[model samples]
Target: MKSDVIADWAARPGRHIVNLSGGKDSTALAIFLHDKIPQIEYVFCDTHKELPETYDYLDRLEAFLQRPIIRLNAQRGFDHWLNMYGGMLPSAQVRWCTRKLKIEPFEAFVGDDTVWSYIGIRADEGRSGYISTKPNVHPVYPFKELGMTIADIERILETSGLGLPAYYSWRQRSGCFFCFFQRTGEWVGLKEHHPDLFEEAKKYETERGGEHFYWRQRESLAELEQPERIAQIKREHALRLEQERKKRPNRPLIELLGAVLDAEDDERGCDICHL
Candidate 1:
């Protein structure tokens, strides 16, 4: 049944939408599908707490696709929802952020309409894509079905002149700057690359009910931002990257960065936001 998606995608009775996360796989999927699915609508479920690089990458992708990438968001931003949760910063164990900032708004956008959600999960990925609870919204994995791998994704992006997001240089996942899923190295990268955003993330780390809520477990942004801490993280990251590079001498720098970051901690990030 899954094998038939590509053949009848156009004839399917639903609105087709490719959800972009401003990441390589999703962007490449959009590039691959734009000409094939003319009426396909591209969308980004903006948490509004994302990096500036993410928005810029989306603009470039929009131009390449020559289609408007619909920007969807919750009625209120992250701050509003954070307050609603009583200062409990969303962690892996309790991620209220994904539902409030992403999925809910996406569901609202479609509003009971039959929709085909295009996901970019590739052949190499074993993880599932965003399978909506809404019966009307169906997921179609073109990359997986087509046996497209990371190499294919990178090729597509490179060919389109819309390479990976600028954040890719340091961060693998593209979500909130203060995403609890981020590794210590990524936090270091955030501080070095986008210090203001790093500071903004720090503000969320607060003491509520005598317990300090931190994005990273056992560590606060304030602690992570210290000069010695930053240097330590950088040194550790460099060492890890060197080991990974030695393992795959021919791999691209971006891929190496991903490997090194994942080596630090591979939580797979927020499934919905990483899409």
Candidate 2:
């Protein structure tokens, strides 16, 4: 059934687009379909708040694809949207960021044209892709149709020479530097690696009089960065990593880190931003 849908889309005459999220799966998907879909358009929704490493990775990918990966920017960036929503930082519950920064720009890019949006969701994963509600936009998952998994994605990247983004060593996924969906350990990683960006994230948590808006629902970035808190988060993460190693001794450290982080907080991230 999946193969039939994929085949049908391949034969259909329309615009083909692959939205790159600067993550491994999407990067692999771009490499996977580069030759197969010659007319396929690759695009990245720039939040302008993305990590430097993300931008660098995209630049490398553009070189590999030998075509420009169109960068779609929200008319206004994160700070502008943050103010529009009364300084309330976007959280998992109220993710205006994804809607405004990612989906809207993507929709505007496609306009009314019939589009087949290539999503990099793998067959081993059960999560759904972010299919736009726009009637003209259709979502297609080649990885799922081909039954490709993490190992296949790794192979694709390795062969392409693009490899994974530098941030993958500490942070498993790529979105924003201060994405609330991040685990405690990832937050620590951000603070350690990008203190300036971490400080900027801290500034978002304002306590004007009595009203408080924090990136993390439980604690502010300032509090999270405290020595004791950072130590505790690292210790807990290390314990989980050891446990995962016992269970899957042959698993790569990066994969194990992702699994441990997921176990710590299994909240599904915004597919548009994280995929």
CA lDDT of each candidate? Answer: 0.86, 0.89
Each model's TM-score, in the order given? 0.95, 0.95
Looking at model 1, report the run of 10 residues with the lowest lDDT sum.
1-10
Worst 10 residues of 2 by lDDT: 1-10
Error of 1 at 210 (Å): 2.4
lDDT of 1: 0.86
The best candidate by TM-score is: 2
| Residues 17-92 of candidate 2: C-alpha lDDT, one tens digit per residue | 9999998899999998887778889999988899999999999999999999999884678888888998888888
Note the clash tally of each candidate. 0, 0
> Which ranges of candidate 2 are over 4 A from the true structure?
1-8
lDDT string, candidate 1, 202-236, tens digits: 88788877778888887788888888988888898
Instruction: Score candidate 2 by lDDT.
Output: 0.89
**Which of the numbered candidates is closest to the native, going by highest lDDT?**
2
Among residues 3 or more apart in sequence or in different chains, the pairs in candidate 1 whose N, CA or C atoms overlap within 3 Å are none
